[model samples]
Target: MFEEKRSILEPAGALSLAGAEAYCKYYGLKGANVVAVTSGANMNFDRLRLVTELADVGRRKEAVLATYLPESPGGFNRFCELMGGRSYVKDELLCRFVFPERPGALMKFLDALSPLWNISLFHYRAQGETGANVLVGIQVVDTEMDEFRDRANSLGYVYEVETRNEAFQLLMR
Candidate 1:
């Protein structure tokens, strides 16, 4: 048991599975030869939940973002167009926004963007804390980046890209 070998200590649930898969991919090892040690017998729902939550990040599949959009017509639509049209794949984007704290803000946002971008995940919380934070996920094509930025700038919204944020790297990739 003390033999010298490279060992990876992974979490007890979904993250462990993702880690094992990442390891095999990194080493070009076939599943037939690699043994992934994951024990589910001692796992609890809470821990499992946490594992599931982090599994995507562990695999670099999701991203957390903080975007600010104007509280006006077509703002959300412009954002969606910038991201890419709806209909996304697994490796798309997971974006979050801090919406304006005002009447018709949410409606204006949704009305302008829905049906165009396939929202994979959405969460809205009004903390009465100056801005409404919203999280969204969409697919984006790399070639249209300049157009995206131009569209975003024209929308008259203060937006911040958080895909490279430290918290995102630590929690969501």
Candidate 2:
């Protein structure tokens, strides 16, 4: 909107238009007349996410979404069955991440991770209201765990290591 109209819109200002667009896309509506009454009151980019959060989830699906799975190939099949869909690792550290629903969040995460460490497990789903809870499994040796933590912390997203989680031990190890 700012690029085309040269006007900055707060989250509330663009909410109606955003919702309308989401509705159109989710239902695959084409060549239809729609109206949106947009209004704003000095909001920030953080809250601007809520505009789409209220958009019946079509737009939200565009963001990074994640979930965990078992390491065995059979776990993949079981997971798929559980979700009614189809679905690795040594010294793999599990971490849950609050991935923002922004455009570059996924790439940002991969850019930080892929080149340096091996990603053993990854699950993503785009249905979060605020963002996706991305669970990433990485092949980080015990000695490198601290350095890995530092790298993760520097990514500007909230994350925590789940190596000691009992469910992870039973499911992955």
lDDT of 1: 0.59
After superposition on all CA atoms, how large is the RMSD of candidate 2? Answer: 9.4
Residue-level lDDT tens digits of model 1 in 42-156: 6555655455446456557666578999999999989988986544355455556777787787666555455445556667755444786776655446664565555545545
lDDT (0 to 1) per candidate: 0.59, 0.76
Give the runs in model 2 whose Cα sits over 4 Å from its true position. 1-88
CA displacement after TM-score superposition, residue 49 of candidate 1 (Å): 25
Q: What would the per-residue lDDT of candidate 2 be over residues 1-173, giving only the tens digit for each residue?
A: 65477665676677787799899999999999999886666766666555445443544545556788877769877876787441245677788888999999989998887787998789875544688888888888889877887888889998978879998778763
Give the total clashing residue pairs for model 2.
9
* Top-lDDT candidate index: 2
Least accurate 10 contiguous residues by lDDT in model 2 = 52-61
